[model samples]
Target: MARHTAFAAICVGICAAGATLGGCDRPAETAAPADVFLANVAEYCGKAFSGRVVANEPPADADPFADKNLVMHVRGCEQPSRELRIPFHVGDDRSRTWILSRTDSGLRLKHDHRHEDGSEDKVTIYGGDTVDSGSATRQEFPVDRESVALFQREGLKASVENTWAMEIHPGNIFAYELTRPGGRKFRVEFDLTEATELPPPPWGHE
Candidate 1:
């Protein structure tokens, strides 16, 4: 009887250990679906997008493309916008390129300003608040202070307030817009139709 009881207790101990291990693994399995979806979105965004800046606020004084090309592409759209790159130009001059991504805390925006000779002017990173809008995600970063200095340094005499908006369409397009304090707005709509193949970044050079 003593031997039988001892055997039963050992069996119960083994079952308890198995149960504990199973419970520990459950959370990982439950999170897999979300991880997979985000991974897919990131993969899609990793492709370079070729599109024109269809609109702008305050309008460019001269031809928008006469200087250089203003094009945008996504590096990745996962939790981290890891390798996303955006380029802006002024008369054959690539003035600025922005690298940004999403994080658990919020959205991160990095600006790489360059001179005509391919020299780095300034590198700055800005963070903002992010919100999900179901079909699309919106990121709002305060520009009142940062814009004042950045715009001045960049030789753009624009006093902007309120927020900058970046909306992702999940598929092939991403839209960027800036809303100033006085209600003046600038928008860039990126259409991916002309994109033959997606390239990796630094503006995804073919």
Candidate 2:
């Protein structure tokens, strides 16, 4: 069907490249499962949706849902490189963005926080990469070494074990979640059925 064609369009070239190399370092690159997954979410580009924190048992160092107006804007996509920039806004603060980029292994997710002056936050670019070929609608990223180092440098030792996830149940729901050491967990789910007008770009992104 057409959906399958789109999947092929996104996945085939990367796969063929792997074969040309005689084999790829990351075997998952052969099928490009994350490529299909990215393509699925890319369908929502330019739209914004509201969400609520469904799970939040915050630890002492954690602040969950301090802002009620939660919005996620699937703002940009570059099909050639397989990248997505989703700005996550909460109330009046436009400081957070979720950057997803394709990799030979799977996918990488980075939390890019910025100051009002468009400067990167001290703890920015901290996140993880997928360890497996996740499904077309879901993916999990375990904290990567670079993120651990960043957290340690920022005195956020507790977040070194962070694990983040994103899910899309086309036309139904889209969700983001975080889990870290010490049983801390936070989750927010967006209603994909109701698309709101796009909000302003996140700080440093405009």
Best by lDDT: 2
What tens-digit string does per-residue lDDT give for candidate 2 at 54-128?
888754455645656999999766553367899999888899999998886788999999999999999999889
Q: What are the per-model C-alpha RMSD values against the true structure?
A: 13.4, 4.1
> Per-residue lDDT for 161-197 in model 1, tens only?
4466666555556666667655567766666544435
Go through the candidates in order and give each one's C-alpha lDDT: 0.47, 0.80
lDDT of 1: 0.47
Candidate 2 yields a Cα-based lDDT of 0.80
Least accurate 10 contiguous residues by lDDT in model 1:
31-40
Q: How many pairs in model 1 have backbone atoms within 3 A of each other, for residues 3 or more apart or on separate chains, i.e. clashes? A: 5
Alpha-carbon runs more than 4 Å astray in model 1: 1-41, 63-70, 76-83, 86-94, 122-136, 144-157, 160-162, 197-206
TM-score leader: 2
